[model samples]
Target: MTKFTLYLAMAISLIAGKVSAQDTTFELKVKLIANKIDAITKEEKEALKVEIEEVNKQLEAGTITKAQADEKKLQLAETRSKNIETRVGQAQEELKDLVKQKVDGKLKEDYRRKFSITFWDGGPKDDEGYKKYRDSINNNRSERRTTSQFVFAAGVNNLVTNKAVAGSDYRYWGSHFYEWGFTSNTRLMKNNNLLHLKCGMSVMYNNLRPTDNRYFVTNGSQTNLETAPMNLRDSRFRNVYVTAPVHLEFDFTKTQTNAEGKRLFRSHESVRFGIGGYAGFRVKSKQILKYSEDGHNVTVKEKGGFNTEDFIYGVSTYIGYGETSLYLKYDLNPLFKDNAVKQNNISLGIRFDLN
Candidate 1:
């Protein structure tokens, strides 16, 4: 079970068939302790060698100073030396028990069976037999229907006002949206992997940059984009949301018929399509403005509700083969509430599913 037990077994077995009247228990104890000390010294010294190599590599890579490396080496050497002393002490205690058992006729051939090489059993005695045994266990396993994927989607973000996207106030190139999270896909049918219900939680960041020197201003629960007094270098508004998304996915990956006549489905290998919607609550809303005031550069950060909707719902779709896909999503709720000109946030991006 433990290495020390194996060492004691070896010590006893070494002199078993050739024991002479001159071989006393004290001599046996001396031999056993000497072997254990040698083993412990070798083990600790090798470990110390590996640690010293790592420290040297770090120093060569400029990650540590010479003094730091020297200090680390000293610490590692001290640790290994202590380990040698402690392990040898433990081995001596084990040796004492073994010597007592030897005198009392308790130490027998069965004590050496833990090594596995000298003992014979009905199954898996050799390396080839053990490998086959392991393979049999692996081959009998079945695949699970539900699997998870890490989702990532990033693209341009913009606003559409009055059902018009061409003349929106936000600059399309300057605005962006990033979505990342994890999703789980479960086969809807027991026999087929054709249709799956995919659902997950995600975090999304949507940013908007006004075309002109404008920023959002809030007045009595009303938020509007208006021109700033000074010529602004940069002005952007961002909204972060935690959303739950659900999609019905069509996976056309070919199924494999194994020797057992089972259908093994490999998802995302061929063309696929997914249609879904998301609903979420906004985490936070903030605006940043940078401008020059009287020959001095200044930056301002404004955080508030800004009359923005706290609850958001959206429709999204993706189509592609394998792990990469074309993605698009549009908000059903307006960007600002109770405004004469209603604007909705929309985005198009590339999606990746790492399963």
Candidate 2:
């Protein structure tokens, strides 16, 4: 038999043992009555527990005579027993009526559905084996990792190559890029609950604004950093890439679950860290110019090779408490090809992971 069925059988056997002196009919009735009483609500279950404790305290303190304590215990048992009997009687009456209809060949599909045997419909009631089983189920659920098919993160983006010219001082907020992506995590090292491998596609948008009113201009395959026609309010060199990121994540947070057995999102309360890298081809590149142009105003968007390498590769790491963390990434390849300055891309920002 399945584990659940075995537990049910054992529970019935134990209940039968309690009434060994009674006749077979009486024992059967007791088993049915036990099933009904087991359906009590959680609050009622707590109340029952409190009642027992109160009686024990009263007996030890001599607040009530032994006879009185005995009477109180008897009253509690009698009340619950009556409740069980009442429920069983109503159910048995319904069953008899249905049997009569079935015997008469008058049973319908609707009637069949209405005739299910539900001893405890509210929730699972406490029994020796059943309570343990429920706790085990909850514990197993908490150990299971939660997975999200899509994750998003954004923060400061920059170029790190050529540290002399690629310092944070040269990076401005307007020029700071943002990165966000969608990925799926698969549990790795089943024996090691903390380890997981995440792989997914992400889009990186890197914006570069020179300290001076300057932008990038392409001359053939080479890009020249030159001054703009006007003192620009905002100038950005944007690179778009479709990349695949892979990370090995190690989580130090305690996993938890709800009654439904779904993993709870607790990124905020736990420590999570990941190390990984990404490689992808650049899909597009452009330079945006926003400055006062004539009286009618002017906006320029230049799209071309921009001297940037078509393919990109990068290494990144993130650490944080909960879902939000400090993220750092550095490109392994130069930002531009056949250029005097061999600048590499670097970004620092906050990333929020949905796992």
The residue ranges of model 1 lying beyond 4 angstroms of the native Cα positions read 1-142, 294-296
Model 1 residue pairs with clashes = none
Judge candidate 1 at residue 224 and give its lDDT: 84
| Best candidate according to TM-score | 1
> Candidates' TM-scores?
0.60, 0.55
For candidate 1, lDDT tens digit of each residue in 139-184?
A: 3432667887767666778988778789778877678787766788
For model 2, give the 10-residue run with minimal summed lDDT. 19-28
- The TM-score between candidate 2 and the true structure equals 0.55
Off by over 4 Å in 2: 1-146, 164-169, 255-269
lDDT of 1 at 40: 74
Q: Give each model's clash number.
A: 0, 8
